[model samples]
Target: MNFSEHFLHFIWKFRLYKTLDLFCVAGEQLRILNPGISNTDAGPDFNQAKLSIGGTYWIGDVEIHLKSSDWLVHGHQQDPAYDAVILHVVHEHDQPIYRKDGSQIPVLVLKNLYPEHLLDHYHQLVNSIHKFPCEKQIGEIEAVVVNGFLSRMMVERLEQKSALVLDKLSRLTGDWESAFYCFMAKSFGFKVNEIPFELLASALPLQVLRKHLDHPLQVEALVFGQAGFLSGSFKDEYPRKLKKEYAFLKKKYGLKPIGVGAWRFLRMRPQNFPTLRLAQFSALVLKSDRLFSKILEIEELSDLIKLLAELPVNPYWIKHYHFQKETKEVKLQLGISSVHHLIINAICLFLFSYGKYADQPQLISRAIKFLELIPPENNTIIGWYKSSGLIVESAFFSQAVLQLNKYYCAQKKCLNCGIGIKILNK
Candidate 1:
């Protein structure tokens, strides 16, 4: 692998790429003053640096290189930033170089110092398993190292999602619950039906919903209306009644359906048809008063399971999918396992966000461990997501743990980050 390939390792190995170094280029001996921009997505890994060369210190912009010739190869010599570069640090030095203004830039070569083992480990990580790009055998990395790594990895994971979350939050008028509802429903739709589910959410409003707090029937109307499922002449007796109620409610509430259909049903397995699933979700909201707040207050996993079980759809739905398919009454029930999975996901997200407010992660851990006692749910729905490399295993009510070892953890970046001076000086 080339030195530029593992730039973070290079920076961390040597102190040359820091923002807190007082040093200058084109002089006898350079002193470091500052290090900047360690986590920026573009440009130099570092943004600002200070240093003195010999007895003369120049305070200006900073530039980095894997080798001296990279200056011209990377076309940095033509950039004005090179003019203020106080130090020129390289992993390997092949020749002298001058900036666009023709001022000679001083250089320090680092390839002779960075450790061999670190580079080897890097290749091992990048070249081994190709799925997640960097997830192979991270399972083998040491605990402390992997923990820190996963912590950062989790942050990165969340960071990638934050902008979308912020966007949803804005759309929901800054309501975290509404944003979360949209998010969960969309995720439940699992990529294929995501837009349909999001449309379902957008079509159904919370305020119009509160008008039918005591009647699951009105709630079903709003949900089915939002889903655009009312057009098919729901053939069963109960469906007829629901349809009548829906028409009345629609006119009264000024409700307009989103024109979505059974989203797709002919090819779906019996358990996952759009009608049954939406009914289940609608039942849940009808049964709970402010579902998220209740979820937040629930501390017991079993109780959480029962509370979910208690969220009844329509009593008549107990034995049917459509208001009346005359099928074997499967109880139209959510298994404890499904409830546990959702609860754990909600709990983890809550703790992840509000973790600073309480010392209850261990409690949450206990609750999650308790959830494992329940039997796992087997379904094509979960297996489909699993096949796609996303987390779908019931065990995920816990967390994704990647093990780390000396190859990654022992190196202290500032003392520990990949782009710190330690790797450069190693």
Candidate 2:
């Protein structure tokens, strides 16, 4: 079975390789004092390693490869980054390697050093065709271990989202409110039209919208106009008025509308149309003042749910999903599931990002607690985890499982995953 370089890194980092009676290619006795830190960035695989070669202490970095020739294949022989690599660990020692300073690096072949069973287990995992490589054995793991892993994965998920939020904040020049608006708008579009909504938010800043918050119609006009929805002529009085209002606002703000093709409507439910989503968003903007600040003050999950749920879209949307398209009159209120999604993906992430930016730990704690209070999401990914004997109690675990499946399992980063490590060690 073909194995990745990460597999070798995993064995050496965990000391799964045979430690006793180890020797270098030059017949020198080798003993590991410390394996050192694993570097994910450039240069050495492991840095600041401590090892004793022939009873003499050596302090430097450690480089690992499938073969000794790979060192030269990767151009580390000429690069100064490998000059500090005191030991070259490989599965097969095919050639000798020298540092840039013309000094020889010690080679240790690990092909026969580690247990064959460990390699067999890893091969089965990486080479498997199942949805999860270890799906068959996942149920055998202890509940406490699984729970601990999920908890850590949840934080990992949060950090991954936080990176996006921080990047947006940086681009907005620390404008947290604008960043929040962009995230919220994206969530409003859900997955189908998220990009177009984000583009709309970026084109029309919250500062410009605040000037017309007193008039919900003008707010709707601004959003719908910037989204390129009001560009076409409409027979309906409400849309015609919005078109006129948007014409004035567009010229006043010097706003440029995104491409009309950006918003998608094919195969989408009527309620999820970009037009309805913009209407609902306009309602939210009208109802709330300093929306991000208000979100930061919300501690209870019920309050947040009610806050998002009670938003009323423009009356015209009550009977129409789009301009001049009449549907049966119904409450155009945001659905419970949609609200929950916004709270999970948008509000919670914003709160966590705010806490990080403002150095407020309580806000961070509240954000996590808020996730725990929400119900687990029902989706194909979460369904897969449940079928695999993983019990998802709340949104926290579900989010963690989602992150694990998408980032770790799908990418085949088994050696880096806790569940994969457990299976390999077992």
Candidate 3:
């Protein structure tokens, strides 16, 4: 049977093969006291293993391959890293292997010891054309197992998002406030104009905006101007005022705006237009005094929501979604759903990142607690997981499902998934 090295890894990791009695191809009895921890980096496949071969106890690393000759194929003979290897585990012992000192290495063959059904089930799941590898068998898993795995996946997702935040913080010389500002701007763009919003934030730093925060119009002018919307002629008086204000501010700050073409409005609702988002973002900047500090003090979900809620947008945006276009009058405040999105994507990510870097476990606990308080996001990808019999009632679960879908299901990494492991083990 043809199988991937990953499949072989699974067999070795779980000791899926029979273990009553084992022997090496060199005619010596073998007993595994411990298979050791699996290594993901360079060198050995498993590290710090303990074994008894021919009544001699040994403790070192174990290297695995499809065949014994693969040891030489991988060029391990001359490398010093492999010198500590105490055993060679192979599916087929086609040839002998030796250490750099020219001493023979003991080999164990596992071609027949493992159950064939396990391989069959693994192949069936990975080779399937379904949306998820174990979509069909997922229903059979107990809720406890499913929830446990999702809980893990949720934390993994948070860690992954936190990594981006931490990277930004590092680049800013550990400036948490600036990192939060950039990420918050990106979240305001809501995926469509994310890149442009990020660029706008970079061009106009938080310190520059902070100086003008006492004057709401100047704050709006800086954000709008840096976004590339303040340039060119406008038919409306509001934009003309902003254009004049921006011209002075741009020269004062020596700022260069991103290209106007970076913003996208195609297939987007008027309320969600980039212009409206920038307007709301400007209002948020003015209202959110020491925003990162305020976020750090927030304990309750309601307080966090209140902090991000119902900013008094400028009167100019009350009847307009663009610079020169007028539409029906609309309340220009963030919706509850949009606020929840900000909490999930920006607030939680920063909290988690800060907790990890600053060594505050309480902050991390609060970050996760905030997710539990929010409702699940309504998106097509989430709806599909709900249809698959998965409970996705909170952003916590929804984030987990998104992570599982993107990292495990989409990539067909069933062997590394808890759900897949449960299905295959059964």
Best-performing candidate as measured by TM-score? 3
lDDT of candidate 1 over 72-171, digit per residue (tens): 8888766664566655666666788876667677775555444566666555544444333333333333445533444554444333444566677677
TM per candidate comes to 0.71, 0.96, 0.97
Best by lDDT: 2
Error in Å for residue 358 of model 1: 13
What would the C-alpha RMSD of candidate 3 be, to one decimal place? 1.3
Rank by TM-score, descending?
3, 2, 1
Each prediction's total of clashing residue pairs, residues at least 3 apart in sequence or on different chains, is 46, 0, 0
Clashing pairs in 3: none
Ranking by lDDT: 2, 3, 1
Which scores greater on lDDT, model 1 or model 3? 3
Runs in model 3 lying further than 4 Å from the true structure = none
Candidate 1 vs. true structure, TM-score: 0.71
RMSD of each: 6.8, 1.6, 1.3
Segments in model 2 whose C-alpha atoms lie over 4 Å from true places: 100-103
| lDDT winner between candidates 1 and 2 | 2
lDDT digits (tens) for residues 296-372 of candidate 3: 99899998888777686888888888887889987788889999999999999888889998899999999889888
